[model samples]
Target: MVDYQIKIENCNSIDCADILIKKGSLNIKYGPNGLGKSTIARAIVSQARNDGSLELLAPFKGRGKAGAGQPKVSGIDGIASALVFDEGYVNQFAFQQDEVVKNSFDIFIKTAEYEKTMLEIEALFAGIKKAFSDNVEIEQTTKDLKELRDAFGKTNADGSIAKSSKLLKAYGSGNKIENIPEVLKPFESFIKSQDPSKWIGWQIKGNEFLKLGDTCPYCSTALPDGPQKDIPLAVAKEYDANAIAHLNTLKAVIERLGKYFSPKGQENLEKITKAKLELTAPEKSFLSGLKTDIEALIAMLEGLRTISFYSLRDVDEIADKIRLLKIDLGMTEKLDSVETRKVTEPINAQLEELIKQVGALKGSINKHKAKIKKAIEENQDSINSFLKSAGYKYSVVIIPEPDSYKMKLLHKDLAGHIDSASKHLSYGEKNAFALVLFMHQVLSDNPDIIVLDDPISSFDKNKKFAILHELFRGKASLRDRTTLMLTHDIEPAIDVIKSKASAFQGASPSATFLSSKGGIVTEVQIKPDEIHTFAKICTEILSAPGDTLIKSIYLRRYFEIMDNVGLAYNLLASLFKKRANPTVQSATESRDMTGSEKSQAVAEIKKHIAEFDYDALVNTVSDDNAMKAKFFATEVGYEKIQLFRIIRGKHEDDVISKFINESYHIENEYVMQLNPHKFEGVPEYVVDECSRLLKTA
Candidate 1:
């Protein structure tokens, strides 16, 4: 397997990081929230997409003009594609409006094998597909149908045109100038020209000039005082420019395409244009019927031209439709354009070819269908079982779509399929489902790298394990692939590496702890033996080589975690408090422990400490000045926090108080805590703040 030492520079909190990832295995990088894990995920995906989005990950302080401090990633040579399961993926692709996951078919069923079969079937019908796309007659006929249909103006349900319809507005109040009024006969030549709309516009513009001066606007001649001055009124009576333009457009369309019209339809069109008043209801009905007929012809042509194995119906039914397609060419030349055979001849040839080879085509298609059906069934069962196993009320059903399949989200407790998955499901539920779907996607896609950026940190313990198993150990999981799971939660490591180690053996999962200091990030590989319970980690720390005060702190926590609040625990607590030992709190007063009790506590403490001395440990811990010096001199972040806690035990300080309130006490007994030295769970800022307080003091 290939090993990657990925280097990232100038990306968010990380100024430079050389992270090692093992190929062909699941790598879990566990760190705190602010260690720039998400930034690493983004940098990897940005480089994979190669879409110039990597520039967005530049550090805010260094984000300026081009090349100022552009984020860079290297050493990921072989990884060309990656799928990231982060909040963005969940919000955008998962829990879509109509399906559980957007493009569910492509993710779940459109396998490379499926595509191979489809390409073979498409190759068999390539001639017809090419004919549909390249035929000039078919192309022109489609354009003609669209042009004719558009002239009718948007029709209503009752076949009556909308009031805003151009046809209705142009012809509802008939303004035909068939017989110009006697008063307007002087300009009859202008109205009778083939391009009368242009002249009507010119006359209308000149009429506006009548309001300005009343001289002939076109000729600049003196106005006649007689009936010639009434010419503007006569022009207005005979023309409306906008209506005339629409009417001219309709007349031109009918003149060019009227040869395809029925004889009765052509006569109706002539009567409608010659009508001196509004068109009769019969004329509108005729236009509506003619529009429907044109749309039907377009549909028939589209069906014939675009035939494929997918669009195949019964052979005879399609043949009859092709044979019955007819158009009236009454009183026109017997042109091939008017005969339906002109469109159907080649299509019929392709159809006959299809009929000859249809058995093989159907067999190939049925094989693919059966394979796809099984995949859908298996995909549905896998997702539904995960939902049920994880105690989710929602289930998924994969339904076949025209081109592919879609997974519908169904809630067992609710009524129908969830229309809005994001709205109906909780944040955890959405993430859970999206993650399972993403696992299948990763398996189907088999990208070079699969990045799950903090995928399961939001889930509780049970759901977290449930999702983890589904993602890495379940059937058709992301096993034996180079996957990076960047998360801030350590429970995943504790579960996958320690508790559920045997279960995830097939996944070949490895884990590491990420820690960032200043601007440089580093990692420590966590072996299965390294992750353990808090009590066990504390015991291990007590036995390892370290400062006595640090060991005492671990011992104190161990006792507390174990509920062993004996004399040794109280004595250590008081020593950290800088109070006299052998003192215990009774009902309301502080009482000294009896000599016998002190002796027994010392014996128990010596069992672990071996060379234990209460006064020596107390003196070491109680010296604030000495502890403050140790805190600065120490390089380890966790050791520094322990030293800071000791130095400010009796002192009232905000930094010390925050550590006490947030992390010091036994808030939860069952919660697993990582070894701070190994995991570096302490934030760098917290250490900085503690050092700041120490320096001021």
Candidate 2:
């Protein structure tokens, strides 16, 4: 439980020595209005906040300093202050009263402007930087891969072993060469066997052809007339035949070498063969071009590989830079896998949740925005309920946007709507709204304590009372931990104090009231009268059969007794009267009143007394002796009636002696044990005499 107390000095009517409040779980101060009650509440709040002693008042201490006069006391360092104030106090301390009834949405807009600006900038930077980093990584990877692929073409096409077979053809058969090594070797041998020096040589000048006629060295043919077609044809045929035979032999040799060579040797031989075939192209133009192309491709591949190394280094550097940036931004602590795991795991989780929230909120905002007009027309009741609770009953719309939220309050009925929050409500209401919004914010964060200034100033008396009552009733729920309410309302304070009497019935709480008189602070104990008044009010309000008439009568009698005898005497007298009086009467009629006229007279007398006509006590009792006899018999029974008769109108001592002699007859069956304490120390006659005096008086 929390222990709340207040002390004041040197402010308003209070000054000098500090008044120590009693250590009650609850304490209340009651006084007439304008006695600086609110002032004390404010002072206590200020002191609790500044001096850091508010922990004594409520849930627990927070981060802040305490005000003056609330010093750090022993054994109470964890106490925090929770003060809820009335509308007037709220207005004076929190916000202007005139703004209370203004639209909550507008107020939120005006206040959230700066906060929105900062958050938006932060979110934007975060989003942009993350996107840029991700894009850079992707782009760098793509560029490096493209460079690698470009350096390595689809296939080797520079007359290498792979391309030679694709270009070769069979000699004289007009068929593609199936065995490239055999064909190439045979053709080389044929070229060597057909020596150009053995044949006649000729030259062509201009359009005329000059040829030596012989061509006879290989075929032994004479030259023909004109172009000598026959002689050249014969020599070409014989030479082709010889070339074919030599090519066949060369093919056999190459095949044998291929079979005999080791795998490594064969690979080298294939490379040499490809190079040789590339050199056999017409004019050697294609071969030379292919060689250049292959060389270029090789050089380009080397350059690309080198560039790939630099690119990898650059990627690593960029990644390192990002890691450092993360640490600088407090996003991560290190580039190690463990650190990455520690940092990214939570962030990823949070990011997922944020995405979910953003999605939901976006959808909701869109839906709500779309139905704004329809909601205003069809869901006015729902809107009104929310508005009333939020302290806005006029024209207002709460619109939640995608990136930001908005609230609009309009006075459409007026000539022009007020766009700003400068209309309607008083200062107290504004403070109350601010307090409500603050509470909402705190609830969103789920804090343990709710510290507030006066939050009820702008309300009317009924509202003030209602709010206080609700707060007190909700003590179990609303005050799960502790609540410190500072107020100047004496009535409510008194109510709380009186309630404490029963609330803490088995264990009473401590209570203290401090008042300033003649510049000195004095602690005034709540008087019994004040306590009774509170008790009376509570009993009337909370007790069963809560009747105003009964309460009024009780109060009237209570005050009357207070002015005369003490309340104790009044209580005792009332108890005696209730116990002594007969609550019910017999309905049976007496046998002596048989005649109609006699019965009627007796009945009339009975009726008047039964009706509580006290005058009838004297009127009906015309004979004093008979009335006394009857009164004595009814009081002490029939046996005591005889004693009363003997004591009537006689000297009290003599009458008492005669009654004792007869009443205490030892032989009398009716007489049982006598009280030794009543008659032992005194003579029998004295005891009897004292009894007779009690009867007569």
Candidate 3:
């Protein structure tokens, strides 16, 4: 794999060394503990996970703590400088020492067994409780249903057939149709033992009455003299007498029968009424209780359904209640096997078995406790063989117990005898043994990386170095995979590097010192060469005084001379005051002019001087020492001469054209020059005007 390097600038106290890390076997970093050497390593790891520059890796004892500030990282593809792990990386290979390791195997076995037992026992208790509750509920429900059904029988209060028969008899012949004789046969037998006379006018109808029913028998009158006989005399006589006697007798018999059966009917009605009344309250009470019970049962069942176990005791109770209700309602035929008390046996049997299994697991755990110690002892030879290749050779045994396991360390010589002193290894030695066990377990499953944090803390220099070497170089160790070792010592790191292992320094002393003072990384590259160049430039610029350049021009009279000769001399004349000259002062007074005329003349003189031929004037004034005095005098005189000539002569166009052409050449020359001197040079405004005049010409 390609090696990756980290570069950080102005991050922390790192005034001296910005880091460069290399990747590969036995990678070493040599730095003091407080420096950001560790920070840099963490930063690389952080950058691998995220974006931007690497930040100072903060040291955290555990996960999620911030370690160092942000560090700038470079060279790693797709990794920016901003990412950092404040906390040291999570140590994937963890080892327990002292008591925890001593009792681990026993604890493991016991905890597992206890958990199994608890689950089974809890399930059994729940089932037993449910069965008890269901049985109670079913018994109560059956009793209530039976009472309610019995009440149903009592509450029927309608009178018997005797009362109905009495009412019919009171209505006399209206109640007696021709078929009454056949209908009354059963009644006749019911009352056969009683006197027929006591039954009064009760009689069977005969055909003899119909045979002689042509006349009204009571009056003994002949039938009406018509084709149809309205009535038969004998039948009418019999019907009339019998109807009166029959009504009287039926009324008497009904009255007698009512007296006899009335008490019994009342007694029976009262029994029914009392039964109904008794049943009504209890039935309602039972139903209300049942509803409440059922609702409670349903709630319980619903709760139980949500639990791990599928069976519910309340459901069984409900089923039993339903069966009882079915029997009470004469619907027992509708009750099925599934709806009865069939499940109790199977559920009880399963619960018993579950309890037995829980007991068995507890026994197994106890048995394993002793066996695990023996097993670990037996396996010690194999473990030592494995550790021997990894540079350490101590027999470590883990014995399972009820609460926790006991860990024992022994040399090969201890053999079959249990050595009490062997269990008392130092903290570091215990840690080593635990580490071996952990590594053995972990290496069984393939892993990509192994991170160790201060694992050799308690060991001496030699031992620490030895362990470090073995961890990194051992045959069983990861060859191609990454192994991150975190430590405060530089010896192991230097040793690794001297052995030609790939190494990067972390935690430089300067890093912490510089980071204490706030520093920032800017975008600008402030190189040593660039700084030197900038300083030299500044010194040269500052060396020359500003006044010297100004004095050079004034002492030489460069501007004054250029003005006297150039046509556009007004440009320079406007800028500088001419020196007061004795000859020129006297010459100015000779002009016969008022104060205003003198001012105008001086202004006109200056204007003409501004337009003087600069190049021609410069060539004429060859002596450098007397140039300023000569140029000023000549410029004033030349302006007077030009003004006088212009006023007197008629050659204005020719003179103006000659001045414009000269000005054009000077202006053109200025444009071609890279850096034209300003005061001694043609002004851009004057040059533009001269160009315009030339173009117009």
Which candidate's lDDT is highest? Answer: 1
Runs in model 2 deviating more than 4 A are: 2-28, 32-48, 51-76, 79-128, 133-397, 401-403, 406-422, 426-461, 469-478, 494-513, 518-697
For candidate 3, what is the TM-score? 0.27
Q: What ranges in model 1 sit over 4 Å off?
A: 9-12, 46-72, 123-134, 150-185, 188-231, 234-242, 262-289, 309-340, 400-405, 544-546, 586-597, 632-636, 650-661, 668-674, 677-679
lDDT tens digits, residue span 1-697, model 3: 6644445543344432343323333333322234444544545555565644343332232225454343455665743322111122112222334322333443223344445644663554465456546554444444433332222222113321121232222232243322234424444442333334333233223323434765544345565665334333223333333333433453343333222222433343233222312223333333233333333433333333233222221232332322221111112211212333342343344345444454443444344434544445544544565446545545556643332445555556667423443245555665565554444333443333343444555666566655554444444443443444544443454345433233222211110011111222111111112212222332332344422212222222332334342312232222222212101223223322244533443454333233333233333333333343332232222222222222222224565445434432233221111111111122222323333432343
- lDDT for residue 389 in candidate 3, whole number 0-100: 51
Q: Against the hidden reference, what TM-scores do the models get?
A: 0.84, 0.30, 0.27
Q: Candidate 3: list runs displaced more than 4 Å.
A: 7-24, 32-34, 44-394, 400-466, 473-475, 486-697
Span of 10 residues, lowest total lDDT, candidate 2: 670-679
Task: Give the per-residue lDDT digits (tens) of candidate 1, residues 1-697.
Answer: 6698899998887899889988888899988777889889889888877889998888888766665667999989998899888888888888788988888888888899988988988887776666666566567657766776776778887777666766666666674667567888778787778878888888777777776785788898888887878777777676787777777776676666666555666777677776778778877777677777777767666665555545643343543443443232221222224344555556656666766676677777777778888898888888888888888888888886655578888877777787978888999998898899888888877889999998887787888988888888877788888999998888888888888889998878888988888989999989877766788988887887767777777788889889888788877777777765568754466787777877787788777777777778777777778888788877877677767777865235665466544566678334666677667877777777778878898
Among all candidates shown, the one with the greatest TM-score:
1
Clashes of each: 0, 31, 58
